[model samples]
Target: MILVPGLWLWRDPWLQWAAGCAGAIRAAGSQPVWFGYSRRVAWTAFLRPTGGTAAELVRRFLALYDRVRARHGPPSVIAHSFGTYLVTRALSDFEGARLRALILFGSIVSETFDWGTIVARGQVTPARMRNEVGAHAAIVRLAAALRRFGYPYGESGVTGFQLDELSRSVNVRYTGPWLADSALARYCRGVWVPLLRPTHPPRRSVLTLRSRELSRT
Candidate 1:
């Protein structure tokens, strides 16, 4: 699994949280790769009049993905905040980029991102895509508000993905402060570990069961 962290992480405790998540993934019997920028990315970078920095980051992420895929095959990804936007753009705008699964938290990707297209193209498994939404994520809400001023941000981490009912992307909502350590630990152990470990049924069987459950609702 590849772990991508958000901007200004060097100044915040989330980097430690990310490290804990990596430890959890390692404990779950999977390799965890941490993809970080060479320098600190400040929150002000997002307000740039042009998308130069964002585009460069996407390019770098795709390079990392290619290298990892060539060495260890496709990898599952866990991204937060701007990392989510970077991953989403890499998968959506580029071809031949593959992932086994994706888990996003504090996502800033547009709510209307075309996830179904990526699933249809076999870039990411449909049943394995998850968006962890935080009900009290004020930062994501602020990002959504900034979208009106031409910022490329969204409230998907707050409102979740606005995809169709049949879409395989799962939006798991949690209620709490965004940076609560206890909540993060719980999610890493209880939610993300299961997603990465594959202790459940095969993808097709899981999809079939999900379809049946949806039919009943």
Candidate 2:
């Protein structure tokens, strides 16, 4: 699975939402790998700074995630809204890029996104990393006010993911208008087909220390 779409989506009627999340990950049998954008990306080239085009879509999403992990071993991403900042900068600036699960929606990255060095270098696993927040997402609040002119973007889909530690990574808030095609088919059949189910099971541990009375500010 790997959908990754967002931006003008070449208008013409809109609401593809990664082809309705690639038809709900092909009716939950998986095999998606969508990833478009060879052209037609205008919202003024998604708010300027297009010289590299977000590092050439993070080098074509790490060359289609290493040619689909050299034939299906580690592909599971959902991404939206500038493809969730190009899949969090290709899993935080690449290095043996791996992913067995991740889902974001209408995100614009930068809520101080280190994710503790992408969860201490395992690529993805804070219980498989989901983030679907949408507190009245006005284009992620104009990409958090264009991040004060430097423009990397923020608001974490509007006030989620301010991680400091102990992040289970499942933000999941919603209200409306996150490009709603019935809220992306009810979050693609109730939260990304049961979290990219191959019999689910990803509740990892070990990164502690975020208790400040369960903080959120």
RMSD for all candidates, in order, please.
9.9, 17.3
* Strongest candidate by lDDT: 1
Q: After superposition, how far is residue 170 of candidate 2 from its true place, in Å?
A: 15
Model 2, span 83-137: residue lDDT tens: 7887887777786797888888778887778887877888888777778787437
lDDT of each: 0.75, 0.72
Candidate 2's displacement at residue 187, Å, is 15
Candidate 1 lDDT by residue in tens digits, 28-78: 767788787744443544666246776777788898888888876787898
Cα error, residue 213 of model 2, in Å, equals: 55
**Model 1: residues >4 Å from true position, as ranges?**
38-45, 175-183, 198-217
TM-score of each: 0.81, 0.30
Q: How much is the lDDT of residue 33 in candidate 2? A: 72
